[model samples]
Target: MDFSLSGLWHEMGLFARLVVIVMGIMSVTSLLVVGERLLVSFKGMSDSKVFASKLASLLADGPGRLDAAADTKFGKDIGYLGRTLRAGLVAYKGSVHGDKDLCFESVARALERQQARELAVLKRGHGWLATVGSTAPFVGLLGTTMGIITAFEKMAASGSGGLGTVSAGIAEALLTTAFGLLTAIPAVMAFNYLAGWVDARAVDISEASNEFLDLVARRLADGPSEEEEEGEESEAAA
Candidate 1:
């Protein structure tokens, strides 16, 4: 019997074929997830940097500049940080006229909620990669177990206990294990890399949110600026 992949494939039983097919699907799906997550991570980082730069300039201008956040265009290009900041700004604006502590608390809650949501979005699809990394090897082992059983059955029927009688079967059985490792290693690596990126982004968001809260505290301490008062008056007039 030919021991090449094609030859081994032909000799494989139905269960073995199904195992290969399942592993193949898993491999393809993992690659797709890796590509998608890398794209998202990179783009999100870039957009966040831009947003942060712009936000720094706005904050430097004065707390009243927060009004500009309402006019800022938010979309995929704005990224997660922009969304979180917008949520905080919206809360701050709505509650700025209320009790100072209540206003701060409202902004804090908004930031926290948005941060959790953004983290969830960043972690999307990670579970699948983890599942494949952890389970692919076991799935392959299951196929190998079935192949060995089939081989032993053949040997019993042939009334042969020779190495040659079982060697081919054992080799075919090991093939699934090899494929399983092949599928799993890359998935594990990808999951680790993406997880690191997500962790770093989480830190960035935490720091940014904290800084934003500090800015809010300072603004409240100073009370509403003249520009903010004028803006409110104009809105009230309208």
Candidate 2:
């Protein structure tokens, strides 16, 4: 019997073939997920840098600038920071006329909620990657185990204990394990990389959120800006 990959494949039992197919699917899916996540992360980073620059200028003028700037078009697909800030801004605008403490608290809660949501979005495919990484080897091992059993059965049937009788089957079984490892290694690496990115982004989000809250606090302490007072008076007159 032949022992090359094609030969081994031909010699493989149905279960072994199935295991290989499953591993192939896992590898493809993992690659797709990794590619998608990397693209998103990179794009988000770029968008966020631009958004941050704009935000910094607006913030320099005071949080009141956000009231008018809120309606300004950033882009359709802003990054995590943009989305989170937008949420907080909306909350702040809505509650600005209410109690000062409540307004601050409302923005704080909105920022927190937006942070959680952004993290969740970033982690979308992480579970599948983790599952593939942790289980692919075991799945391959199962195929290997079954292949070994078949090899032994063949040896018994042929009434031959010689290595040649079972070597082919053993090799075929081991191929599944190799496939499993191949599928798992990339997944694990991708998962680790993605996790690090997520952690770093989380820190960015936290710091940005805190800075925003401080800005809000300072704006409140200094009293409402003339523009805000004018808006309020206009509303009262109407």
Candidate 3:
């Protein structure tokens, strides 16, 4: 067959095409992962905002916060945080003016549970990102090696191997390696960005929880008061 465009297309070997296909599949998988994680991140931010607001509204005591928050739409996702805050409120209530040990313990435990739940959500998809980042270059390297092998084979066949025989194979081989890296970079970037965002949000949530708890404590504090009539009688007697 003449080495025209159509000839090249028809003659292009299976390995070159296979490399392309593999790269294509990797690209699609990485994109899908990025999309899913982005969606989750956005939804998580929304859920966090809503959870904070609802919990703040009913933060007077454990029972009140629980009664108010447990039935909300974001219930299960943030139930642990709500329960933790409630635990603190309950501990304080049970010993309104008692030692800080029990209240601190209850709140601390609840906060830890809340952190675990949120961390789990954030940890999702990182493994895929890591896999892509680590494996993409190797995929490219394999393609390059295959291409080099083809070039060498063609060289072997022709007693006097020409540049053309090896160039095409080398080009095709390197393309796969390049292709792998192209698919991997974006995935790595997305993973890093999303992971950092999740960490920041977790910190924000922790701080917000502490702030709300203190507010509840402030509202509960009481001071003794004297009557106006008693003050007036004392003044008159003097």
Candidate 4:
């Protein structure tokens, strides 16, 4: 295709317009991902905080009291901590007069399940974000290559093989690279930020679970009074 300078500019301008449109779409997509991830994270955090608080109170009251107390109403928003604590507390109740090792195992399994569920929720948009981040540059490069090739072909046909002849092609190529970066940067950043927060939350859940188990072990071994045990349990859960 023999493209004149004016023709190349017109074509590249249209291509730039397309890049802008894609960038706008990508921006919207990135924001949507951010919003969705934040909603999940905030819900998790809110639930974790409240559930941990309730469990701390229950632990102080005594292992015997956890069964009845765990069932009170938190409605649908009860969150991960509630679900996890309820399962563990129930297991502890069953084993209050049974094998010590078995109770620990049940609670451990419950905690693991909760962690897995939370992790699944966190992972929802990560793949999409990564995909966009990896592919945006290539898309831009594609457009740039097309524009440049068209410009070069035009110059070759005209037999005017000077910088002026190919300038539009180079310009189009540069535009594509720039547009690709514009689309990619935010997607990459959001993926990293959300992933990091999720990892940190997982660590917190682990620490809380470990402390609860240790509290149970201590109360069993020490034969502490209910009041003392309750206080210790709250601190462990806390």
TM-scores of all models?
A: 0.92, 0.95, 0.71, 0.75
Q: For model 3, how does the per-residue alpha-carbon lDDT over 101-204 read when each residue is reduced to its tens digit?
A: 55545555666666677667667888887788778788878877887888898888876578777766766676667788897888788778877877886777
Superposed Cα deviation of residue 62, candidate 3 (Å): 14
lDDT of 4 by residue, 203-227 (tens): 8867877877776666455554576
**TM-score-superior candidate, 3 or 4:** 4
Give stretches of model 4 more than 4 Å off.
1-10, 13-24, 62-64, 90-98, 218-238
Arrange candidates by TM-score, descending: 2, 1, 4, 3
**TM-score of model 2 (CA atoms):** 0.95
Greater TM-score among 1 and 4 belongs to: 1
Q: For model 1, state the Cα shift of residue 200 in Å.
A: 1.1
Minimum summed lDDT over a 10-residue window in model 3 is located at 219-228
| Of 2 and 3, the candidate ranking higher by TM-score | 2
Q: What pairs collide in candidate 3?
A: 140-177
Superposed by TM-score, candidate 3 places the C-alpha of residue 210 at a distance from the truth, in angstroms, of 2.8
Candidate 1, residue 136: Cα displacement in angstroms equals 0.5
